[model samples]
Target chain A: MKIILDAMGGDNAPDAVVRGALEAAKEFGVQIVLVGRGADILASMKAQGWDTLPDGVELANAEDVVDMHCDPAAVVKQHPNSSLVLGARMLAQGGGDAFISAGNTGALLTAATLLVKRIRGIRRAAFSPVLPTKDGHAILIDAGANAECTPEFLLQFGCMGSFYAQKALGIESPRVGLLNNGAEDTKGDPLHREAHQLLKRAAEQGTIHFVGNVEARDVPFGAADVIVADGFSGNVLLKTMEGTAMFMSDMMKQMFYRNPLTMLGALLCKKGINGIRKTMDYRETGGSIVIGISRPVIKAHGSSDDAAIRGAIRQAIRAVESGFCEEIRANIGQMILPREEEHAE
Target chain B: MKIILDAMGGDNAPDAVVRGALEAAKEFGVQIVLVGRGADILASMKAQGWDTLPDGVELANAEDVVDMHCDPAAVVKQHPNSSLVLGARMLAQGGGDAFISAGNTGALLTAATLLVKRIRGIRRAAFSPVLPTKDGHAILIDAGANAECTPEFLLQFGCMGSFYAQKALGIESPRVGLLNNGAEDTKGDPLHREAHQLLKRAAEQGTIHFVGNVEARDVPFGAADVIVADGFSGNVLLKTMEGTAMFMSDMMKQMFYRNPLTMLGALLCKKGINGIRKTMDYRETGGSIVIGISRPVIKAHGSSDDAAIRGAIRQAIRAVESGFCEEIRANIGQMILPREEEHAE
Candidate 1:
């Protein structure tokens, strides 16, 4: 399988991305296609004592770079030759099995959907990010990808999220949960209530394992394998978790450096603390996967380092290996679109 | 100001409630009326080495106790003499200037609204809680109080939340931000979009200081003094913050006690860490003051201990002394009611 990497996507681009790609290629033995400005990629390669591209590794040239502030749809349309857009185009045309970018999320998402297109039966594409928790990890879908959604769209998100969890996370029967105001079926607004009923019916038919509504507080504790929420709430939850993790980590550092004795204690437990930090790091899990598209496209964090870029490439590989797109297409195609049409009316 | 306390509420019950009330009464020089089984209050009183009931401290007999499982509205009607209901009633009827309860939140909110009633022009009441953040604190308004709301109702939340911050937290021209998926005016669903427009209008009129939309990640860093969101989203944010705080606190404790050296280090910084813990403790800040009510009524945490219950009582006194209810009535009354009516049509 071939994976295209945006070498200029993240903060520590080229070096970090190239190094990470080399590591992934060495370990996974998958073809690594670095897509970026030609000279920059080659210079970085030469700096690492590589005169030429190694076996199982190739370079794809793209002249221009898409900055983080670029308009997603406009950039993809105007600069089809840009690395970010071309990466997605390559995947669509089967030049590579998957594409990864740690550039502008908006551009990445737009390129994936507009270029690669959504799978048949998929109402909308959802982004699922694996959140690390005490009990392990849980997937939160539509994490701010599409802000507004109908009940049918949310149902589709659940199906897509569940399949991703089953195929990628290796969960036998992923417990799917609807993120709602309360656990009761009658808890949320009309959209949530309708989705609850649909999910209940689906669960009864064994289409997906529904665990009912899980509140935001339970998200960090790994309440379910696939936690589906509208983008508005899911975005808030995701950012809140990220912000809290950073805040707590900062506070811990302060506590450790307050005095000599505490600093000593910090040093002693460095390994354990590092373990916890690693668990919370986004790079370790790769970036969020833009699910429901016809091809695998992963979004790396804009500020991601080479490590994160490489992680995103690895995730792309995993997505391809797991047949994520195919699974989503299969599961989502079963939904009745007639009700959705009526609801729109 | 005379404050009524529900001694029968919370995990610690009469013991913590009685002790906290006595302490608050003595410290603040405000009358505290403990409402519960007289025997339990008196028994705990003697154990605390009190020779006589302090000045401005008294008790009101209420035989019934509202359990966490009881239906909120039903309980208020069924148990008119229940501690929680009677306590709020005292504040409503001018028997007490304010009321405090660390009981069932649903019960507290129901009784407060039904008995105390909204101020003449106040449409819906709001529950505001101070969330701890790295940048200090941010007020999350309508935190699960009014789930479904019009944009105008949310505008009132911003105003009321701003009032609370200016009076309580002492921020001048406090920044009010609408919590949404993204920071753009066009970022969120219809509710958020309309709310953003209303906030812009309010800012233009110089009625309330309005900041642009803020994301959840910025919430922990005190992005704005008053963070306005619909109750559903607000509640989720509140609980997420609470859960994250608890999780971090627990993890810190576990880290400290993991080894003998770390345990010794914990001992050395015991005073400093305790100080931090005390500040982070929601008990110290008391509870949400059901804003827009005719009188001051604080909804203490359901699991509050003696210290927390007393803190709630004191918060009631502060709310009354600061004329928080009157301020909200005067500042937010006109806008809030008319907005609700307009949205109803």
Candidate 2:
């Protein structure tokens, strides 16, 4: 299998992406096509002591760079040769099995939707990010992809998330939970209430295993395999988790650095703190996948390091081998609205 | 000078409530009126070694109790003499300076609105919770009170939150931020975008000190004094913080207990950990205030223990002294929409 990676994307781009692709190529036995300014990629690799490109790894030169502030809608028309758009085009043309990027999320979503395209009959593509749980991880669908959503959109999110969990994460009959303020089926506003009804109907049909409503407070407890939500709430959940983790980490550092005894305590429990970091760190978990797209495409965290990029590549390879998109296409009937047609973004 | 306490409301009432009121009355130099069934209050206090009501403490007999699952709309009518309703009624009748409970949130909201009433011209009563931030705390307004809110409601939340932060929290010209998915002005759905515009105008009009858009990740960093959001997103943000705190606490416990060395480490650094707890604990922070209400009303956490309740009572005393409601009433005109006559929830 071959993977297309945007080496020019993310904060630590070129070096991090190139190094991660090399590591993934060696470990996963997959061909990696690094898309970026070819000379810069080679030089970054050379700076890290890799004087030449190794086997199973190739370079795709794309001169233009996609700015983080660039308009998503205009990326296709304006920066056709940008690394992000070119990577999407390569995946669309089947030059590689999957495309990976850590560029501007909106730009990538647009490129993926317009160039790589969504699965047939799918109304909206969802951003499914795997969130850390107590003992495992749960997928949060539409984690800021489509801020406003219809009941139909949520239903589709539930279906797509279920499929992704089962295939990519190897969870069988994933429990789909709707993220809400309360646990009752009657909870939430009109949108969530109506979405609950649709998801309930879909569950009865055996398309997905629905576990009533899951509150945001119970999200990190691993109560459900897939937590489906509109992008707005999902994004809040994701970012809140990030903020709390950061706050606690800072507190922990301050707590340890207070005096001599605490500093010694920290040294003794370094391994244990590493365990906590391992569980909380997004760097270890890989990237969020753009669900409902025609092909596998992963959006790594924009600040991801080389090791983090390797984790994302591993996630991408697993996604490719899992045939997650095929399952979505085969189960498309379950995702569509009964008699209503809507505009697809 | 007098605080009415719901002696039969929370999970640990009337034991915890009575003890907390006793502590608050002694420490904060405030008069306490404990409202509940007289017998239960006496027995619980007696069980805790208090044979009679202490000096500065009094009791008001209320025969009924409000269950957590009780409908908020019917609480006043069905349980007229319940602790929560009686407390709100007492505040409305000027029987006390403030009322506090940790019972059914809906029930409390109903009592506070139907009996205690709202500030005139205010469209909605917001549940403004004091969230722990890097340095101090930020108030999250509409933190699950009105799950569905209009842009006008959000504008009011900003105004009310700012006033509360300035008066109750002792901040000057409190900065209000609209909670959104992105920091950019054009980031969220129509509701948030409209709310952003409204908040911006309020800022220009010198009604609120607007700090533009604040993402959930920046919420814990103390960027703004007040974070105003529609109830749904605000609730998600609040609960997500709780969930993350719980998850981290659990992980820390397991990490400390991993081995003898880590166990000793935990013992040595116990004080620092307590400092961390002091920063993150909701118990230390006390209750969320019902903003836009006629008087100072606090909704303590449902599972509040004696210390937590004591903290809430102290908060209530501060709110009463702060003249928070008077400030809201004085500034109510700026919160009202020009021509939109919406139903007040």
A-chain TM-score per prediction? 0.96, 0.98
Best by TM-score: 2
Question: Which TM-score does chain B of candidate 1 obtain?
Answer: 0.94
Q: Per-residue alpha-carbon lDDT of model 2 for A174-266, expressed as tens digits?
A: 999999889988889988998898899999999999998999999999979999999999999999999999999899888789899988889
Candidate 1, residues B115-148, lDDT tens digits: the string is 9898876668899887777767788888888778
Ten residues in a row with the worst lDDT in model 1 chain A? A336-345
- Cα lDDT computed for each candidate against the true fold: 0.82, 0.91
The C-alpha stretches of model 2 lying farther than 4 A from their native spots are A340-345, B340-345
Cα misplacement distance, residue B130 of candidate 2 (Å): 0.9
Q: Distance from true position, residue A40, model 1, in Å? A: 2.9
Clashes in model 2: which pairs?
Answer: none
Question: Tens digit of lDDT per residue, candidate 2, span B1-345?
Answer: 999999998999999999989988999889999999999999998899998889999999999999978878898999998888999999999999999998889899989999999989998898988899998999999899998989899999999899888898999999899999999999899899989988999999998899999999999998789999999989999999999998998988887888999988898789989988888889999999999998999999999999999999989988988988899899888888767443321
Candidate 2: residue A331 lDDT (0-100): 92
